[model samples]
Target: MIILLVLTVISIIASLYASFIYAPTELVMGDIQRIFYFHMGTVWVATVAFTTVFIASIMFLKSGKRKWDILALSSAEIGVLFITLTIITGSIWAKPIWGTWWTWDPQLTTTFILWILYIVYLILRSVAGDNVKQARFAAVFSIIAFIDLPLVYISARLKRGISPVVFGPGGGGIESKMLITMLITFLACTLLFIILLKQRILYEKIKDNLRLLKSRAI
Candidate 1:
């Protein structure tokens, strides 16, 4: 864990340098296009978060373990936080480039749906009352809801080439420097997600222990 923290800090610093300094300005959108570095970082991490939830949910279903439930919830919480970041950053980038705050574009619409589904997953965890029942419902619902994750990811590709794609046609023919910067930023985001997910799982464990203690004490 200590080594992971050190590596995470280094990666983030390197990513910032690469995004702001090493990467060249885009001829089309100028420096504003630089938003892609961090924006796409959030998108990548959010995708990871949902994938973690999906896998953890599957494990809980198979093993019927409380820890797996805790992991799924932890991942869902971080996933929600990061997806919110993605939407906000996308809107900020959109305003200057697209001259609008939002459009019901295919990817955007699917991302919105993905966000709402996980939000509902979190709510379900709270409302279920019984821990076992809550875990069961959350696991099943997440498995079902995860279907849209792939939809959100490939929305641009799946479109009939009618709308403009964000990362269009062979990864937008990006320069090597820009691609490297984005990849570094994505790695930093992945490390951050891992750290946060671990901390969140620990928090849930402590909360559960407290509840158990209180019931026994009473």
Candidate 2:
């Protein structure tokens, strides 16, 4: 854990350097484009985090394990945090270019919906508390929420909007340096996610143990 934390810190520093100093400024967007690296990083982490929640939820349903429930809850909370950051960073970048903080572009619309769905999932989890049946219902809802994840990506392509497609068909590819910087940022974000998830799971387990102790005392 210590090694991972140290490495994550170094990688984040490298990512910061790469984003601001190594990558060349975009001819069109100028310095504002630097936010793209951070935006992409957050969105990537959020995608991974939510996917973990989806898979963990499935496992929890199948095996009825507290560990899987802990994992799902941990991932969902981190996923929501990162997705919120994605929206904020995207809005910051969009303001100068699109001349607005927000618009109901297809990608944005779907992302907003995705965010709301997860928020609802979290609420369900909180309300369920220690109720096994309610928790299972929340898990089922999470599985259904997973559907929106892919839609957020495809919405940009299927319905062209203010969001620029940086990859795939109808998109302009990034320069090699910019691509490298993006990869570094992704690495940093991924490591951060892993660290946070592990800590969160550990914390949840501790809470569970304490609850068990209190119940025994009662």
TM-score, each model?
0.93, 0.99
Per-residue lDDT of model 2, residues 1-218, tens digit only:
99999999999999999999999999999999999999999999999999999999999999999889889999999999999999999999999999999999899999999999999999999999999999999999999999999999999999888899999998989999999999999999999999999999999999999999999999
| Prediction RMSDs, each to the true structure | 2.0, 0.6
What lDDT score belongs to each candidate, Candidate 1 first?
Answer: 0.87, 0.96
How many steric overlaps are in each model, in order? 0, 0
TM-score of 1: 0.93
lDDT tens per residue, model 1, 61-138: 999988888899899999999999999988888788778878887888988999999999999987875668766987
Candidate number achieving the greatest lDDT relative to the actual structure: 2
Off by over 4 Å in 1: 160-170
Off by over 4 Å in 2: none
Clashing pairs in 2: none
